[model samples]
Structures are given as C-alpha cells and as structure tokens.
Target chain A: MQARFSVDSGDFTKAGSASSAIKRMLKQLGVKPAVVKRVVVALFEAEVNVIAHSYGGFIQCDISPEKVNLLVQDTGPGIPDLDLAMTEGWSTATDAVREMGYGAGMGLPNMKKNADSLQISTAAGKHTEIRMSFSLKEGEDGVS
Target chain B: MAFHRTLKVRENLCKSCTHCMKRCPTGAIRIDRGHAQVEEAKCIDCGQCMQACPHHAIAVEQNLFEELFYFEKRVAIIPAVFFAQFDDQYSESQICQALYDIGFTHVYPAELGIDITRLYCVKGADCKPIISNFCPSVVRLIQTRYPSLVPHIGLKTTPSHVTALFARLELEDKGVGIFYVTPCPGKIAEFHRLAEAGSAFNGVLNMDTVYNQVSTSLAKNKRKFAKEDGAMSFPVMTGSAATWALSNGELAGRKGRSLAIDEIHHVMEFLEFLEENEDESNIDFLELKACAEGCVGGILTARNRFLASERLRYWATSLPSELPEPLVQRIMKQKDAMMDKMTTPIHEVSAIALDDDIGVALYKMEKVRKITDALPGIDCGLCGSPTCSALAEDIAQGQASIRQCTVLRLKDPKEVNTLARIWGEKVTGEKGEGK
Candidate 1:
C-alpha cells in the first residue's frame, strides 16, 4: 500500500493528517501497538519538520508486509550544516514556529531514534529529502 | 484479569438517533442495524453514553440486594461529595449515622483516605503536572486513550479503596466486608477491580439506590453518632484541597502551575494538548474529573450538581481540621505502606485492532483513505454515519457502501455507481456484471 500527502509550510491544522492516516493504516494492518507508535512518532516529526521549516513539501509512504518506507521531500532552503542540524537542541525554526511549539530541534533526532534506517540528502538553498525505513517484525529494533 | 464494563443500553428504550455514536471519546459506539451498540473493547466505561442518551436507554451495573447480605459484616464507605447533597444543618456525624440505619453495620466517610492521599501527593510528587488518579474513569482514559502519559499520573489509590483497606485493618479478626456507596458507574466498575486484587471491599451499591432508603431512614430515626469538636481527620489547608469534593477544588491553594479540568470532552482536549506540547514541564499538578462537577454530578446522583457544589463550598470551608501530631503520624505510617505501589496500573487497551496482520491493515487503510478522499467532507450525517471519515471506516470494514452517502449519490450518481461496482469487485474478488 502507498500514500502521498501534501504539507504546506506553517499549516499546523493539517500537519498531522499524513501521519494520522499512516497510523490508521498500520493499526488496521495489525501491527504491534509499540511498533505503530514508533513509526507514527517518527513520521509525525518528519511531517512537522516539513511544515515548520520548508515552504512546502510532500510525504510518500510505502508499506509492505515486512517493512515501511517513508520519504519526505521539501521545497525549502536546505540545511547548510547537516551535522549541526542533527543535534538535539540545534534548530533553525522561526520565532513564530517556536511559539507554536514546533521547532524544538528534536524532530530529526527523534526521527533517527525511532526509525531503523534514516538517510538524508540536501542541496543548500534549494531542497531537502529524508528517507526513513522501519521494520514491521515484532520485538525487533526499528531500523534493522 | 478479565475486562469488565458497567454501561449497557436498553434496546427497548433506544431511538437509534446516533447521539452517543458521535460523542464517544474512544470512538467505541457504533450504530448497528437500528440501535446504538457499544463496542466493549474500545469503551472506557466513562458513563458519557448514559449522559448522552436522551431516551434514558443506557443503564449501569450495580450490586443486587442479596449480594450485600452475603457478606458477614456490611460496612458502607461514603464519598465526601455525598455530604454536600444534604442540607447544611445535618452534621457529618448525622449523615454517617443515617447510613448506619440503612442495612450497614458501620459507616466510614472517604475524607480520611482522601486527606492522607492529598498530603502524600503534595509532598512526594517529583514530576510536573502530577495527574490526579482520583477518578477511575480518568485512569481508564489514560489506559486506553493516552497510554504514553501513563507515567505522569500520580500513584494513589482511590479514596474508596483506601478507606476499605483501613476498615479491614480495624476489623482484623472479624469477617468485615466493605461496600462503597458510589455516585458514578466508574466506581461501581472499580469495585470489581478491587475484588480482583483481593481487597476487603465486597461490592458497590449505587448511590441512587441507597439514597432513597437512607433518606427515609434519616427522616424516621432520631439517633445520631457521638459528635466530636474536631471530626475531620486531616489538617485544614486554606485553599481548595479540603473542598476537593467540588469539581475545581483540586486547584485551591499551593502556588505552582496547576490545572483542574472537568467533564470528559475538556479532559480529552487538554490531554491532547499535553501530549503535543512536550515542553510544558512547568505544570506541577493536574486534577481531571470525568463528571461535570466531580462525583456530585454523577449520573446516579439525584441532586442538582451546581447547587450541590455551592452547598459543598460552605460545608468544606466551615469543617474543622484534624489535630496536628496524630494526623502527622498517621500520614507517615500510610506513606510507608503505600510507597512505590500506590494505585494498580491498568493494562493497555487496544480499542481498535483492525486486522491480525500489520501489512494487511495498512493495505485496508490505504483503501479507506482513497474512499474518504472521494466522499464529500461536509459531515452532513445523511448516510446514517456522523461523518464521512466514519463512513469510510465502515465501508473499509464491509459494513457500509459508498452508495449510502447521499451527497455522492445525488451530486454524482455515475461516480457513486462506478465506485460501488469497483468496491463490489474488490470485496468479491471477481469481475462483476457491470464490468
């Protein structure tokens, strides 16, 4: 099964729709509650990141019996320092975003912690793409 | 332990208006055939269904008369809110004596246990926004609806259970069976939980049932228990802690960040906010009540809750506090006994388990998403469902079809027919006559 949803920057109202949809899907598929929670948490942070930092973005999720792969591609000023952005407290979110409690600099770190495999690629001043994969097997660590 | 729920619907009284179907916080109610059915797996037994039913179709389970006789010595434990229902002239001792006249050998008010628990709560809590565990319904809400915030809920046994334990300790050798005269369905259900864990409480009697009998006995009997000048067993805090029987009383006194939320919907909304805003560590205490005005506004209560709360304010304020030294010693002793193992943690409830396999459920949800996107988002409820999303869930589960949605059927009949035919083929797994 596959799903694609568009996310507008700073649109908090619709920010969680994609993550919620995928959560419902995973729940229906009979995934373990803990696994579904982890996947949803990772996807939510990724979705919120796209909406908070990027001008606009799209979320694509592909679910198989064994695993789930999520791709979030955003049209925004790409991360200049990937290593710094990966830090727990480092954030480039605007003041408005911070007031809405969106940019905690924890989104990437959280996504990394929850997802088994996380890959990132970006062209500065252009765009950013993130790929996260999660294992569906019960009792297994998220990435492997 | 086996799962138990107290809420039930009287099919004869149901009009099938779907009022409860839309209002359920857990999405546990479904309109099947003609009547509203409660899905037990998802139901937290919050008594919201009983309140929503205009026809009075919903009924809660209570102890039978014979169940009370089975116990050797029946002791009634009353909630502090029960005292607020009566006229101010009736002292607390008179109320306890009145309960004694109604089949109970002895009566113990819940204030003693509540005081001890509150003292421990104010002193021992380490986390911010310490969620109150006073309401059993609120505890069940955390178990099913907000599992992640379970740790934040303060460790404390309900006043009823705590009082029952104390009563058992007092009657150590005798076969003493404690029974709570409760005002809400949630506490009635909590009785079973206590019994499962080998508590002294034998069962619960609905406050409504005992109220009429006790009222009659109060009018007839002139006898009253010996009244003491300082009857209350806890220290008087100027702020609302003494009046915790009232809905917002939990917020009285103590300076740090605190919140007292009442009613089920407001509690859900606040909890959702707490879940999202993870950085809010400032709040030191949170008091969440399931009923509109705490237990006084329970479904089984006869008095007007607003009036009862007003009456309680006067009584709670004028009531005297306990003597300092003995009370302090009692708090210390109870603290050591209740440390670490306060209230029993409820098991996680999976209200909605769509399929046996994760991959299959995901596949079905994709189909549901497709169906939802196609339907009109007006939420008109013309198709017997409260919202378009609900219809999509039902359709995905093979309970309904897209043709039932009047908007799609009227505005674009062709689209509806095409979608129906495709859905039919998918369900049957074969080429249909239309194709």
Candidate 2:
C-alpha cells in the first residue's frame, strides 16, 4: 500500500515531521533498524530540500513485505545545477536559512548516500521526482 | 541501554524523513515505537537535535525560574546578545536596573567576561590562525573531531568558562546568587559538564525562561535604569569587541596577524589550513566561528529579517575599534603565561581518528544504509526518527522493527504482498523489498 503526506515550506518549526513519522511506521514492522535509520536520513534530507530550497512538496511512500520505496515530489524551483547541487558543499540557501542549520549543501548528497538505486528527475519549473528502494531482511516474514 | 523514552518523541508529528540523521553529527537519534529518541551517551548535547526537531517535540528541559524565586537571589547573567532582544528599549544601562526590579538581586552582564577574553588574547602571536576558544561547543568539536589541533586552541577557556570562573571568584564574598542566561543549548550542555559531580556555577537559565520573566516586567513597567559610564566593565577598545557578539567579531578585534572564518561548511578548508600553515607569523590567530555571520547571530537566537545580524556588525563597528591593550606585543608575554595554563588538566576530544577501524563502523553503517535506502527519502519525521538512518539504527539496535511502517507495509494477511511475495519467488525477490 502507498501513503502520502503534504509537507509545507517556510515553516522550519515543522520541517522534519514527515520524515520522523515514516521512520516510526517502518520501525513497528519486523524491519532491520540499520536500514530504517538510513531511509530516515535520506528522506529528511529531501524534505529539507523542498522546504529550505523550494516550494513545499509531498512525500509518497510504498511499503510491503519485500522492501520500502520513497518518492519525494516538489513544485519548487528544480535544481538549477544538478551536478553542483549534488556536490558536497554547494548550496544556494540564503544566510538566513543557513543560520537555521538547514542548508549545509548536504541534503541531496546525503539522500543519494542513504538511498539504494536512487533515481531523480527534476526540471527547472515543471516538477522534481526522487525514487529510492530499500530491501528487506531475508529471515523476516511479511506478517503485515 | 535504551529507554522507553530516552528523549521525547512526538510520533503524531513525525513524517519519517531522513534529514535528521544526515544532520546528526554524532548519529544519536534512532527511530522506533513511532518516534525518535536520544541515544544518551551518543548525544553531545550540542542541541542539534533540538535545533532540527521541527515539531517542537524535541526540546531541552525547561528552567526552574518561578521555582528559583523560592530558593534565593535570582541573578541572571545574560549573554550580551540578550541585550539586543528588546530592540532600543533595553540598552546595556537601562536593563541592568530592570533586572534588579524584577526579582533579581543583580544582573551580571556576561559580556563583562569579554574583557577577560580581550586581556587574555592580546599581544604575542601574530598571523598564526588562533581559533577562538570561547565557545564550549566549538571546543567540544575540537575534542571530538580535531584532537591533533588541540594545541592550537586558545589556552583561555571560553567566555562562559571565564564567566563561571569570575562568578565564583568575584561573588564568593558578595553573598549574592548567580545564574547563567543561556541562548544556546550547547551552553546548557557546557553548564551540565561544569556543574556536574565537581562543579562551579549554580544554574543555567535558558533564553526562553528569562525572556518570559523579562517580557512580563517590560510590558508592565517602562522605567529605564541609570546611564552609568562603562556600565559594563568590558574594555571595549573597538567596535570589533561588540562584533564578537555577532559573527567574525574576533577577526575585527585581533590587532596582529590573523585570519577570520565563520562557517561550519568550511571545516575542510580549515583542516587544510591547519595542515599547511604557510604564512606562519603573518597568521597568529584564526578567529574561526562556526556560524556564518557569527555569535550575535547563532542557532539559538530569534530569526530576524534577512541578514539582520549585519545590523549588529554595523552598530558594533560604529562604537569603537581599539583594544585597550594592543595585540602582537601583549600576545608574546601572554603566550608564555598561557603555555603553562595550556598544560592544565583539560579534556581533549579525539578528532579525526583517521586510522580507526572505520571499516567496522562502515560495515555497521551499511546495514542501516541498506534499510533506509528503500524508504521514502522525504524527511517528514513520521517514523519518529530524525531521519531514515536513525530509524535503521533503531532497528539495528533492536529498539525498533520495520513492520511498524503502516504506510509501506502490506495489510494483515496478504499472499499478494510485495516483499514476501517477491522473496517467495526466489530470483525476482532476492534483492528487492521482500514479502
């Protein structure tokens, strides 16, 4: 089954709530703790990308006995320079956002670091989509 | 050891995103039980977790202000920046009295310690990038990540330490009480360390706590205090002294050869600079600040208009720009004095254990990476972990399980389930999400 959440931008006070929610949901299942932590980091990085650097976006997730998939779609200004944005220390957030400790330019790189077989498709004004896959443990049963 | 609640985890507000783990310098938070919790020893109390908790659920403990009234004198030694919170209404002089009227026996301005900082760092070393040793958080980072450069840190303890030292020495006979008004959680952590088993200061009062008390008084009465000359004994030589309250203030204050940097992102360059000290003498001190603009604009302060911190830069610059005691010459004598103090018993955080068994940790980290890689990259905090890595860590630690994800997991009985269904099919399910 798939679930969706609407994350808002400019509301730094509520920035990572969506990511936190997803982490907890996966934890209740018989999933490995290590994989859960990585997905949470990647997802939170994307959420920050939308709020700090773009318009608010939505986080779409699909879960099953096999693996979990997360998709983040945003209406914000897509990365002007993907390669640069993908770089470790490059960021466009204003000094104000940086003060909040939200823009270290580590968001996309961190997401890519944590996600498996990551795929991202972003256009300047159209839309940006990021898809990631996480495999399940072998011995674990699909009780859900 | 894990707790039913090591730290507060507001599950309803979580979105299960992974941003927190990415930002977590120490990887302390883990997702489970529909929320994230602090991994005690793992949390350095840098308050990055509190800073990143968008839902306001994750917060440092509140203060015992009203409760303090029952004990004794309530002297709030507010950081200098706290003076700026009241706009032009509360300048240095006026507010000292305001604090007096509002249940505090006296208000010890922490900026007073800036004089100690100024007196201590002046003279001696010229053009040798001296990192400011005033922020305990910055100091802790040194201990945790840059142990080799421990020798380079200014021998003087941070301003807060100096303040604590001064408070005890100066107030021992005064018979009055003292409290530290904190703007950052890092300071609270410092206070925790300082005030632990063998301690100094009495208590730490956070900004929110003091703000509540001050706001009430300001709203009720507008009486300003006396305009005493140098109401603050801080030897303000140049506007640069004031700049210390803001970012890059140390750069402006240095009278000798030095470089100034203010950005956490510049850690790599800093490491390289430390490695290759080319212009040896021309760079006595490196006034490196973690925040981009500087201390006046820290993670804990109120969010102002765009670049509002610059206002402090201009205002401080307009005040004056002369250190009472010049650097270069003074630092020479000060260095000898400090050298003895440098050897003083102080904890050194191990920085960049480059040769440590990273492979072991990496192998451990990879397991987490694998699980998180499959989840939504959206750091919504729905999973209660700060990020996906945190959730995976929880699972690895056995604190949480993956079946908790109702959003991604299949319903009750399902032969049609994705992960199990695929895993049951052998080759197709070998590496994918299994049913």
Candidate 3:
C-alpha cells in the first residue's frame, strides 16, 4: 500500500494537520498501537522539520501487506552532513520555534529508530528525501 | 451521518455555477456537471455556502426552529462564544431578556457549560493538558488524525454534553425543548454523536437562525425581565470564562504557563513541534479549539466579519458579573480524573499474525523506496490521498496500484515491473497474494 503526504510550509499556526491525518489512517489500517506511536512521533518530527527549515515538504506512506513505508520529502534547505544530521543534538531551529518546545535534533534519529530500513538523500541547495520502512513481521512489532 | 434530519433540495433550481465554492468556509461544495456535490470530509456545516449560492441550492438538515417554535417549554443553550458576537450588548442583560421574550422558562448560557469543563480540567493545572471539548470537530479531528494524541484531550465531557445532562435533570416532568444555538459543525456533530449514544440531544439552531430574532425580541421586551448578575450555569464560569471560546481562553483559564492553539491544523502542528523542539520549559496546560475564532465563527454563525482572536478578547472583557457563593466555589474546583480515557489504537484486526518476517517487510520497503526514487516527491494529492504515503498505502491495500501514481509512472514506464525487478521476485500473479 502506498500513502502520500503534503507537508505545507510553516504557517506555524497550521502545522500538524497532516500528521494528524496520518495518525488517523494508521489507526484505521490496524497498525499496532506501539507502532502507531512510533510512526506518530517520527512523522511529526519530520513534519516540523519541513516547516521550520525547508520551504515545505510531504510525507507519504506505502503499506504493503508486509511492510509499512514512509517517505518524507521537502524543498527546504537540505542537510550538509548526513552524519551530523543523524546525530541527536544538532538542530538549526529558530528561537521562536524553540520557545514552542521544538527544533531539537531528535527528528531524523527518531524516524530512523521507528523505521526498520531508513534512507536519506539531500542536496544543500535542492531538497531532502527520507524513505523509512516499518516492517510487519510477527516477531517485530513496528519500527523497532 | 445518518443522524442528520433530511432536507429537500430543489433539483432543477441549481444554476450549476461554481460561485458557492468560493463562499464555503470549509470547502464543502464542488460543482459537478451541473449540480453541486457536498464533500462529507470537507463540509463543516457552516452555512456560508448557502449564503453564497444565488439559487438557494442549499438547506440545513432538520432545522430545530420548526421544533423549537412548537415546544411547550424551550430553553436557549447559548455557547460562551455567543457573547463575543455582539460587542455592544450586555450578555447578562440580554440573556435575561432573551429567556423571557423567547417564551422560555429558563435561560442557560453554554458558559455555564464551561464551568463544568473547568471543574473537570482546571484542578490538574499543574500536570494535565486540557484540550477544550467545546468543539466536537476538533475532538473528531484528533480522533481521526492524531490518534496518539487522543490521550492528551481532557476527559471532561463537553459543555454541550454536560448541559444536555443538566437540562434533562432540570425539566423532569415538563414538556421540554432544548435548542442549542450552535457556532460550528463541531457542536452539531457532538449533538449527533450524543444522540447516537442514547437519544437525549433535542434540537440545534445555527447563529443564522436566531441571531437576528433574539436581538429583535430582546430589544422589544427589555423592560419585563429582571437583570442584575444572572445565575451561573455550571461550576466553572469565571471572569475569563467566555475567553474559553476564543484563541487563548484555555491558557488564561488554566493560569499556569499554558499554551492555547486554535484551528485544527495549528494545534496539531504545534503538538508536533512541541514534541520535536520543546525542552524543560514545559507548557503547564494546553487548550485546543478547532474554529480559528472559537465558537462564534462556527458553520452556523450569523456574522463572519471579526477575526477569532480579536472577537475572543472583546467578549472575555465585557463580562465579570457576580456569581452566587456556592456556584463560585463549585466552578473553582478541579476535576480529579484525566481526560484521555481510551488509549487503544483503532487499526485493522488480523487473525493469526500472517506476515511476521521483519526481513521480508524490510526488503519490500527498500524495493518500494528504490522504485519511486526517480519520481517527483511532491505530494500534490492529484492521485487521491493528500500525500504520497497514502497513495503507497492504497497501492499496498489493493485499492490502487503504483502505476496509477503519475509521478512513479513518470520515473519508469512500467512501475510494477520496476517494483518487481527491485524485489527480485515475480509479483504479477494473484496480486499481492504472498502471505
């Protein structure tokens, strides 16, 4: 199964509506509660990243009968170093966003941990692409 | 959806023009061929489309005015946001005259309902985040979108629910009629769901129905009603009580370092941002309102002129009426229990855990990720879902295939072939049959 997302640029006031829809769809799909939790957390983190740093982006999902797939793509400023971005404490969020309890560097890492196989492709001047998989095998719950 | 009272649409009366789309606040209308089709997902029940349609193609389902006019004992349950609409009129005075002139035995402002909400949410001002239950659409929005955040909503029953309970209790024997003066689709939906659960919800009147009638009626009979500081409707009514209807009333109501976010998307976005960025400077409480301006600009309001923030501030300051000591004390107390009651996920139920191979799931994901690599990553929703992941999920669900996504098709002439090639398996037969 494939799902698509539209990450509207930050009006700050209207940010999380898309993520909310994703969470709802996850519920309808019978995604495990723990897996849904992980997806919500990770997807929300990526959504905020687009609003705060990039021009705007989208998060789409493909749920095969086997695996759950998520792709976060944005036209925002891409990360210069995949390694530094993958770390948990590096963020370039504005002070206004920090006032609201955001811009922490945990976005990519959280997405990585929730998704079994994570892929990142970014161009500093162009865009960033994130493809993550949360497998649905019996022993595995979700993204863990 | 079945809860709505059916209305007759004059079929041939439609001009088939796209004029109504521009007027709809929630984008509920779309002109197809010649008739207008209402998108259920998008419609907020705000009558802007009706006002916009020149041919009068739109009408409300089950108007309460018909029932309200016939009832023996009718009560007007006004939303706290109602006070915000008329800046010049005094709410205490108008409420008093309104009850008497409208031929009702009592006048209960939904503000009293807020008192009940405060009683439920405020005591935990230190730890619990209070998502306002005044608007039904916001709650449903969260239920559908931010299912995980469902836990964060205050467990307190909405003011409407409490008011419905209170009204039934007050008029035990009398032939009773409860007419809710609604501001938006959220309240209308709440009344609908509440009825589906039992059969208590009586009638609802949008602002367009009674705004003018009430104002004219009150003006005509201002002399008969006695008005000082009227009675409190519930336990939690406050100096800032009406503020709860607008942009940041919840923050002001709870008092500690609180954050109030209105507009459904704004609240969710802030939630996502708070999750990603916030630190030790924890927000003591959170207030969520779906309508940008609180309840006043609901799908049912008479005038849609004022900004939600400005009108909210205007109404909150106008009323500081005195309350009875017992009522004051009752409104001040906090509810002990948490609001987010059900933590269970609402996903699909599978019988024996069919596909449990993490390695296989991972490989399939990698293959899909690679197959769509060359497609434009734009989630334009041209393919149906609002995003790309939804389309992918649809593909996985068998409702749609990868070939349908133009972006994926652009990347490779044969999208399914590409997916099959990446997975190193034959997937064409039996269509997604591998268990």
**Which model scores highest in DockQ?**
1
Q: Is candidate 1 or candidate 2 better by TM-score?
A: 1
How many steric overlaps does candidate 2 have? Answer: 149
lDDT of all predictions: 0.74, 0.58, 0.59
- Tens digits of per-residue lDDT, candidate 1, B387-412, equal 88888877887877787788887888
Q: Is the docking of candidate 1 incorrect, acceptable, medium or high quality?
A: acceptable
Writing each residue's lDDT as its tens digit, candidate 3 over B1-435 gives: 332312224458877665666554433454444566665644544445565678877666545566776777777777766655555544555654664565655567676655655454433212245454445665555554444445556555566555555665556627787777777655666677567655345777776667667777767766655544454333334557666676666566345677767665575567555433233336656776665656655655655536544665755565564445776554344222223321112222221111244344434444444534633568554444435654454344344455445566566666655664444434446555321
Per-residue lDDT over B219-279 for candidate 2, one digit per residue giving the tens place of the 0 to 100 score: 6656544455353433233454454655656665347766666655464356434532232
- The pairs that clash in candidate 1 are A28-B361, A29-B357, A29-B358, A29-B361, A29-B362, A116-A143, B129-B283, B240-B252
lDDT of 2 by residue, A1-144 (tens): 466899787878877678766764554443444566677778878887878877778999887656789999888678766788889988898999999877888888988887765898987776788898776646543111
Off by over 4 Å in 1: A10-45, A87-110, B65-72, B89-91, B117-130, B173-175, B219-242, B251-256, B277-281, B323-342, B373-386, B398-435
* Model 3 lDDT on a 0 to 1 scale: 0.59
DockQ per candidate, 2 decimals: 0.44, 0.02, 0.09
- Across all models, the iRMS values in order are 3.0, 15.3, 7.7
Model 3 misplaced stretches (Cα beyond 4 Å): A1-63, A68-133, A137-140, B1-30, B41-56, B69-71, B87-91, B117-130, B222-237, B264-284, B304-322, B326-435
| Model 1, span A68-135: residue lDDT tens | 99999999789889999999999998899999877889999999998989999986897999999988
User: How does residue B241 of candidate 3 score in lDDT?
Assistant: 62
Ordering by DockQ: 1, 3, 2
